[model samples]
Target: MVAKRRQFITDSILLASSAVAFPHVAGAAQSKRIKIGQIGTAHAHASGKMSAIRSLPEIFEVVGIVEPDKERRKKAESAAAYQGLTFLEQDQLLNTPGLAAVAVETEIEQLTPTAIQCLKAGMHVHVDKPAGTTMTECHALHDEATRQGKTVQMGYMLRYNPAFELLFQVIRDGWLGNLTELSGTMGKYANDATRKQLAAFPGGGMFELACHLIDAMVTVLGKPDQVTPYAFRSHPEKDTFADNQLATFHYPNLVATIRCNHIDPFGGPRRAFEVAGEAGLFQIQPLEPGKVRLGLTQPHGPFKKGFQNVPVRKTTGRYDDEFRDLAKIARGEKELAWDSKHDLAVHEAVLLASGMPIN
Candidate 1:
């Protein structure tokens, strides 16, 4: 049985690897190509998401892109991803014939409102992160999607990371007897230009970065019973952005600590998450490559009782699997794993962590 269980671990690893591009999704070759239009290119991930969508010609038909800002549109249209795509007015693109989905990749301020527009137009939307400035905005976007029977796939980049996927498995299958601790740090250096942009919001680095960690934390331990936030300014004289930030989430059994900062000149490689429970511990460092270190208290499944590095497939593109899943959902092949309820929970946690008002 140990032999079988050991091999099962290998099979599990393969399962996650295959989901990178959804290369192994059943009937993908026959997937009804969902006509998808993109709105705006101001968000950082806008072009990347469009690139991923266009790469999957078998799954998504690029109906057109809508960017009202002439400067941004002209700048974006020249990009390789938008080179051959059409540019339409917002209403024109939203009302395109047979349009089934819209990727709401507008600016952070417009993310929720634009997604709400698409939802009210009877379209499923793949919205980029932070949801918006207010809990009310986030709730309205999701509430409209629910009323319209459409899906709202938020752009939480790490949802499909192989190591994080394994973490989900560990939590779900009781590999960890009971999740007791979850902690992560997400940071990146922001230049003057970026800092100026982010300084508009008090959440600062936490809102811009740690939302991803909060998404993962909420997955491991649902809505935090209480969220305690510590927001500080690393460069007080330069900007009002809360560049240095930490939020501790309290749950019935798990306490999750999340930190996000914009002053780490070398923080990218330091991005990491650690979790511990009664039975084992799992850690992923440099989350991009998803290097996994797992320790089991006793022999559990394929993992032996000591700390060891496990091979996890690295992602080719951060948003590839996400758009792939969006297509599958539009084609009625599957449902969103993180639904509205969960997203609302994550959003509320984000607001609390950033010390933004939920009301």
Candidate 2:
């Protein structure tokens, strides 16, 4: 009888242990997955982002890819980046079982529309850069997302950049007191073929490239009272090339410039922006985060000094940071940053700058 009692107690303890273990085992399986879908391979940056999604097994599961263009699909498959991934039809990709979100890396013209479809279908969206050609499209898309209670994170990857974060803090802290002048350059080396391709694009360089700087400018200076755009087609007779262009924005107490061109050479360093105020100046170099240099007037000094490097909190590549942030928001860890309202403002800027009629 004593031996029987001992066996019963041992069995009860073992059952209790298993009860505890089962939840963890189940949780491990749950935590191992984040069903991510890629909904286009039209953007130049798509492959890089796709590869990153594939490599991070603990955080993501590349459930499917949606490729509309056969050429692009072939290229994606040939590229080592998409070796083991399955490409699905658009409808199938959108309706995939347990699909959490879709990355809209389509052509610039298709970005806003495709994103709208994804969000309407109860999936979160990760749109590529220069969200849309016109602001109205962006606004309509974001409004629908708001109504659906879904997220639409625009592809302004640099905002997640660490240096820009510090710059934001400094600007807000008045470290650069009463910012007066802001200037940014969006330029890159372009061959004949690239230039021709860009020339075919309307609004030329401003819409295609300068949007980044313009967005950043709006971020730093708020909405401007008046905008005087200086668009020029430098090689008008040669091709539909609006190579050199500028947008001069006038704010309450600030003036900003956006310079865009395809006149630079390859392998050359690209310049981002310089914000100057009465107290100090901040410079952000392209593709390098946490490299913000701030130049402040000594508490009491007459001499003008050069910029001194300021400490910027480091952040990892945007693909990881953005996804992690979105996941955290989804998991009730924090609030979403690029909310519907914020996206509306961004879209408004894109439209206003594009000279598109705002609705």
Candidate 3:
């Protein structure tokens, strides 16, 4: 078991090393690719991300997949998502040559450790949300990642969505002056399969689901002064997991609320975010299909308020924006928008809201 684990890590590390495009080397004139590795196949989203990487031939190469669990390994191998990908033992994965970075898409319990291992190896890491179970571990991993000069990107998918892009632009442009409050909701039908998959985690919906909103909240507004959570087991018999969760994060300048529940109807409101400012408000509904409503109030002249529906710019692919952004960072052409501190702060808020002990 120990040898197998070591081999998996080695292969993951090697696959993460990107081939250099030195000026003097022939055939190096082509654009360099960011070689990314995947750790653990337990995460359902891992396969989706792998497919996205595969589709983006210009940005990334899906090199190695590390699935330590026997059952998960078999399932991942047979899954269409794993087609045309190399599978390796953990140590072999870590030692893979020409590797650039690793995506820590393991079970929630393994997210932090896997990311730490990648960062300690002097490689960038993209970790899934609700980073870790404990605040101390989250901070420790973040600090180590920083010390090693690695980027620890938290997987907050909404940040890269096009509708939110316009909202953020309006706020930054000062069109919406003195933002005071913001609220966002991510609702999905937590069917039997989802319930079974999420039952493995402890914090239920708050940790498993709501972290996406919390991260978005922090992105639009800075860290909250206090985060108060009101959670419940809405479906006691459905599964051991907490099905209903809400957290109100307070800021001196603004107040934010994140609502997540496992009971949304199949075709109910998909996801939405509303930010209100002294001047006006901005809202995005059913974030997937991209419906945006932007309202602005007049400043000095005759008071006026109007709404405009901004057309949604189609994204190239699933999380493709994020992968391309990371490639830019690797090439020293872009600064890390999502930093380690932001992740620690977001996770800290989640832990606090859950009434979990924090360090």
Candidate 4:
């Protein structure tokens, strides 16, 4: 039995390694490709998301890109990601015939506004994370999309992560019992330029990065009653950026802490999410190329009572399954996994956790 388990683990690791090397081929068969347009390239993940859309030739057809800022357009044009794409004015892109959706990849402050315009234009929208700097705007966008029956997909990448997907299932199955505590951290070393950019926002690294983990936590724990945040500058020499921050979400029975910092020596590997419950504990470290560790009070399914490493399929890339899910939702083949109400709640909690004013 021990030998069989070892062999199975080895085989799973080898398969995941191959998947990392080669992108996952999505089996989306649509009569016509979803005509997708992109708005803005200011967001850091814009190019990467666009590249993912382009890679899935069978699912999406990039109609055009809208960049009102001339300098931003000029700068993006030289990049390989935007080399072959056509640039159009906002109205032109919104009015494009057969445009099914738009990826609102704009600056953090512009995300909600751009998404609102796209929603008003009768198109599904894939707005990037940290929906916006304000909850009111985020709620308006989500509410409008809900009324229009349009899909408003927030680009919270972990929703599609294989390990996270499994963790969700495990929790739903009651394998983890009643959740008592959850903790996560997403931090990295930043250069001076990055520090300067982050310092512009009061939330600093927490707003820029911790929002991702907060989204995941809300998915797992639901909305918390109170959010207490602690913002600190671990390295004042660097800049005024709130380089280190921690936010605690308080629930009746659970307390969750999410920490983000700018000075972890090996931040990538240290990024993690841990859930502790009466029945067991589940943790995933280095969220990308995710590795899951599980502990249980009693034997369950194929897992032993003690801690054991579990194998999850590696992602092709960050946005591989994200785009795939978007295609399915656009094609009316699948309902959005994360609906607007959930998104609004998550965004509200995120703002509070980031030490931003709700009103």
Candidate 5:
């Protein structure tokens, strides 16, 4: 149990390494740019996802967009990312000729159902996170995608970050021998409106934000043998809002901790993940477009002993690499890096950690 828990690279080492070696060119066949569309501009990341797709013009062509809600559509229409792009009704966009894939960026609850619709319409999908607040929709969506022979890429962007890419290799190679403890913090100050929005979900802070780190945790540690959750409130006068949350994941010889809060003014810069092994310590704070710190007992590869900095290449934006890879998978040039089974494992862990009902 202990050995399996720390085996971060259970998926093919090539699957793990391809992230570091991103922009991996497929066999001699040259594939054309995939024609893609966006659905539902209400999600926080909807515009950003659209922008990322447009940025990779070499990999994808923006066919059109779908935003069902009139108010949300009106707001998104004027956003810089959506300007000049045609906005069509849901059916029109899904039925567009040559529509190879869709970015399902609906409001949190609609994410899975929207993606499932695209899959049924013969489009691959990039659905955003938490897979919704429960397991039922997530299961149905994955089942439909599998039945349709289409890819459903969850919107967890950290998997492609260069720092995480290298860290996976370090731990997998036994550079961090015998992982003993791991902890991560994800938090941001949220006002009344935000808290009320996130509170609708069972885990509130942890479900809304910490799920990102939870995805990272399960990626490195696998699902915890058991997870003990602590949910409490820091909201001034609200009782239902779990504004502060923590989960302790139990393993045979390892312990992992995930903490999230809606009350950190410095939370943006404080977001961090740290791993402690007998041989070394690896930490990344403010974890996106990641900056890393490494402490080693002895030199490993080109990295020196003691605390040394690992150079992370400049990231144009977090979504660029994922969308580029999405294009390849949509074009049949490559297989999905992390498959449906892995995605379900991550969501199961997320629900467990968030104190949400699994069903």
Candidate 6:
């Protein structure tokens, strides 16, 4: 049975890679400039995403920003990225004439609520990672967006990453035969201030960082039968945050583990994901400027059996493709790549993995 499965996967890899290699390109003529707004700047990636949206003048026009926290607004105003951006109250941004979409970039606690408000206001939203702390609120927002036929694009950046896109294609093509084990590690050195910021969440580093890998794992493996989380505060610092954590996801056919830490000496180059299967293995390190290494049982297509470095298209930047996709969905040029069902499942898995209460 295993041999047959391996053969099947090897055969399918070619077909899968072909389909993913040539995705439907969004056309310039069909592109419409989407009038967008941003809500909150407390999330770490909020300013970066806003700046990215502002750069894409042809596809998006960021009309205004809604930041409720005076302190947070003041901090953001000092950043060059947020400079010159209109600051409006939440209601004003939501009620702006011809508003087409909103980017929900609030602190983790406020993500779902703000997204729900945007959906209620008849605007599509790009809610950031983990989809907030609660499953109920995330579901409520997703359901409302579904009922209104609006898009809720989760800010899981890797979904738009070219390297991950190639990895997904390889898996779908059966090039990796019967995925047995998948592992990912994401970590960084957190300073006193960053550690304090992360200490606010129970899951700490895992909640803030590993959620990215969890999103990718769930995308490839779907919902797991069980998620076992091991959270720890390995640092000597006097903080209650769980600075080191690992979550093992058990599925019928696959067992995956994700490890995250806030104090890795070599975290930058060590950030990586690996997939091991009956027929092959694939690894990507330094997930940002993604570099992939592929291994097969035998030579298949352009890849050799032992190992080979796979090259992918250069990433324009983190948020460029994501905002472009959002604009396309807002303009009715294409349906959302991820639907409410997928987002809901991903959020559920993330909460479970992060050791957060789902109810």
Best by TM-score: 5
lDDT tens digits by residue: candidate 5, 195-312: 7788788778888788888887777887678988998876547757888889999877788999997788888899999988999999997697588999999899988889976777
Who is ahead in TM-score, 1 or 2? Answer: 1
**Which parts of model 3 are misplaced by more than 4 Å?**
1-30, 299-305
TM-score of predicted model 1? 0.92
The TM-scores, one per candidate, come to 0.92, 0.83, 0.86, 0.90, 0.93, 0.91
Model 6 lDDT-worst window of ten: 10-19
Model 3, CA-based lDDT: 0.72
The per-candidate count of clashes, in order, stands at 0, 1, 38, 0, 0, 1
Candidate 6 residue lDDT tens string, 227-327 = 98889887656788788889999988778999998888888799999999999998999898999999999787788889899898875578877887777
Instruction: Flag clash pairs in model 6.
Output: 13-173
lDDT of 6 at 1: 41
**Of 1 and 4, the candidate ranking higher by TM-score:** 1
- Candidate 2 structure quality by residue, lDDT tens digits, 31-85: 5467889988878678877866766676677888989789988888887878888
Q: Report the lDDT tens digits of candidate 1 across residue range 1-359.
A: 32243234334434544554366554544546789999989998899999989888877899999999989988997898799899999899988898999998898999999999999999999999999988899889888988999999999988878788888777666776766788999999899999999998878888878999999887767777999999988787887878889999988766789999888988899999999988899999999979999988887778889898988766657787788777767877557777677789899999999999987
TM-score of 6: 0.91
Candidate of highest lDDT: 1
lDDT comparing candidate 2 with the true structure = 0.68
37 Cα displacement, candidate 2 (Å): 0.4
Between candidates 2 and 4, the one scoring higher on TM-score is 4
lDDT of candidate model 5 versus the reference = 0.82
Error of 4 at 264 (Å): 1.9
Q: Candidate 3, which ten residues in sequence have the lowest lDDT sum?
A: 14-23
Give the TM-score comparing model 5 with the true structure, all chains together. Answer: 0.93
Q: In model 2, what lDDT does residue 29 have?
A: 31
RMSD of 1: 4.6
Error (Å) of candidate 5 at residue 179 is: 0.9
Candidate 4 wrongly placed segments (more than 4 Å): 1-29
How well is each residue in 1-359 modelled by candidate 4, as lDDT tens digits? 32243233334333333333454432424568889999999998999999889988877889999888989999999998888889999999999999999999998889998899998999999999888888788889888898888999888888777787777767766788888899999999988888888899988888888888988887777778899999998777767888888999998887899999887778888999999999999999979888999999989899999899999876657897777777767877656656666687788888888888876
